[model samples]
Target: MGNDGHIAHLTGPRRPRALSPLREHLRDTFWFAPTAGLLGAVLLWWAASAVDLEIVALLQRERAYGAVRELMSIAEDAKTIVTTISAAMMTFIGVVFSISLVAVQMAGGQLTPRVVRIFVRSRITKITLTVFLATFLFSLLVLTSYESESSAREVTSVPVVQSLMTLALVGLSLVLFIAYVSSTLRLMQVGPVVDRIARETLRMLARQAPGSEDGGDGAGVRAPETGWMAHEGRAGVVRDVHVARLVRVARRQGVVLRLIPRIGDFVMPGTPVLAVHGGTPPRRALLRYTVSVGVERTFHQDLGLGLRQLSDIALRALSPAVNDPTTAVQCLDRVVQILAAVVHRPLGTVHHRDRRGAVRLTQRVPGWADLVDLGLTEVRAASVHSPQVTRRLLAGIDDLLLLAPEERREPLVRHRELLLQAVEQAVPEAADRRFASHPDRQGIG
Candidate 1:
């Protein structure tokens, strides 16, 4: 039993639809944005060319020789600018992104390889790449429309609108370039990367529909004794589950469906995926569609991914190779931030019921104990030698103890005791043990 009042918002009538596999795949890709930009650039060039032709016709009909000469001169300058942009934009893109990728690679190595996913899914990265490509393509297209002869009397059309649009695109690319550079630099830092992961985790938690308390524990529903659905697709991690669809199918078939593996669990082919209680199991294909499998886990539905990532960073920081305790402390700060949010919420098994109050779908979620262990266990073990990490671990547990309910304090207390024991055994000097024993929010001073 968890805090019902604090979790009431999570028990809602509407359940979010599972993100499709294709949609999820596209979201992590860098090419989609640039491809879209190229198409948009083509359309823009067509429209600008049409407008320029209309303006040229209007000026000629008015017999404005002076204005036409001025327009021709502007077009001449426009050609030079467009030519420069078209020739140099791609090279600029290559140089900037090549450096960015190298920096991202180093950061990933310093922290965790999972950090690269943050760079891929970054909106600023995609948008900047898109604008750069669009600018280059627009300039190239505009160049093709420039007139060979530039005499006011003989000038059939002047690309005034096209030139203006190219200039605007170039300006936009420069602005985005600045933002992109700043964003890439932040990715190299530990604090910002950890914060982003934690924020994303909290957002996923907010999106989760925990269902009603009655549905929290399948109180009346009997265990599924009929059959099981095995995984038939290619082996990968379970990324998302179509809970709404599963509920509907179960309700229609008069059965209760329990998901076998959690969202982040990696399953091989022929692995049991669902347990059927009463009625005949749904089509295997239908069950397969409801679960999304990918090569790696993502934040799409994995609630524990953020904590796991933070733990990875902490472990990497404490590793003998890197040996940076300050970075480990930064990781603990964000880990505490994420765990604090989960402390008060309803967790563990969730039940989705139909209108008749019958349980239709039941899925296992990480409980408070599981999450506490996931976040702290490895870090505590690896931090025995690092007094900074040991103190921060104690402080994090103490902070969690204050916010956690009576029932939830057990995990926090257990972790705190285990951390102290590890520190005592690992630290040879009594003074070091005493320093590690004292809880310091900053890990030392």
Candidate 2:
């Protein structure tokens, strides 16, 4: 539906769709496994106890096992033990979680709010949560088997084994508690967080590795004059695009599709999100599923969003309240390293094609100039009086100029001019301005 409540028509043939296994797994990393894994673990342990205990009961019936009777009595005692411990574990989990939350809050306040997602989406935190929940559920289920009435029907032979297993799990939880403390402390620090973000970004770039992937960098490319436009009906960030699936859909429909938004871009409802050229458009029926929209941007696909996270840290460090130029310089160091890898690589800009050499997708990537600006735009503005930040910012620009191709160097040069202008206005002393404007990683000033 259009914004004012008018009918919209889409032209295309309906076709069946399938997902590749890799993309399916990629979707799971966002929010599914953390919660699902916990529930699944509980079900697993319940099933485990049921199957193992039944087999032990069969062995006892075959052999006249007096030891089995003694074991059952111990298991009855173990039931009370597990139940009491489980409740305590619940309280323990609560305290650990509160401490972790406090650490996360500090990271957000000091680093950047956007990076708060990193802590929220952390694998260690997720796994710890799952284990704690699973342990509690396991204990509750085990205790139920020892109910006064159910004890009569319950197998006597397996009590000792079950008790031992629960005891071992308790021990494991203790170990996890120790590790969780260590992990939380690491998260609260600035060095580890920034380094982690940079490494992930570098890893993502290494996978793409220049000419190995099709990133819209085709020459002499222009959108076809005539085509249908598809408007997205929902508002959210473009979390992931099924590029392979989109290519397949375009191949089936025999059309050239142009995507309007890249990963991490926010899409407003009733906005033109894609274009179809030279054939029938696949329309919302096919397009909606191929594009995954969500409330938060993720690092799963958007390399630029990683840059945004890093830049946010730098900008925050430069804030008046923080006034920590050393931290800003550390962030700038990473920003330059990331840019050197990206600006020289193949940026998907113009076209992507199917196996038959037909144009299946088209896109526009952030140009070198725009990308440089993204890295420095805010920090530069805030560095008006901070000579340390200005020097590091300008030095990073120079490093990028040397690393980037000559054509891409234009933006770095322009940024240099602007940084000098800033230095001139803020630092009245010519010596200070000259030192800050110099292209050394550390300013003599």
lDDT for each residue of candidate 2 in 1-445, tens digit (9 for 90 to 100):
0011111121243212323435444444645654685677567667667765775677666763555565566777787788788788789888888877788888898998877777765667767776777777777766665634333344443545555667877887777777877877887777778878888777655433122233443232344535555545578987766667677777788776777787678888776667777666675577657676778876655677767887888778878888888887878888888898787665646455676656576656555666678888887888878878887887888778778887678778887888788889878899987877766586434
Minimum summed lDDT over a 10-residue window in model 2 is located at: 1-10
Candidate 1 residues lying further than 4 Å off, grouped into runs, are: 1-24, 61-66, 150-156, 211-226, 251-254, 284-288, 353-359
Residue runs of model 2 more than 4 Å from their true location after superposition? 1-31, 147-157, 207-226, 348-350, 442-445
Which structure among the candidates has the greatest lDDT? Answer: 1
- Model 2 residue 151 lDDT? 36
The best candidate in terms of TM-score: 1
TM-score of 1: 0.89
- lDDT by residue (350-386, candidate 1, tens digit) is 7766655567777777888889999999998999998
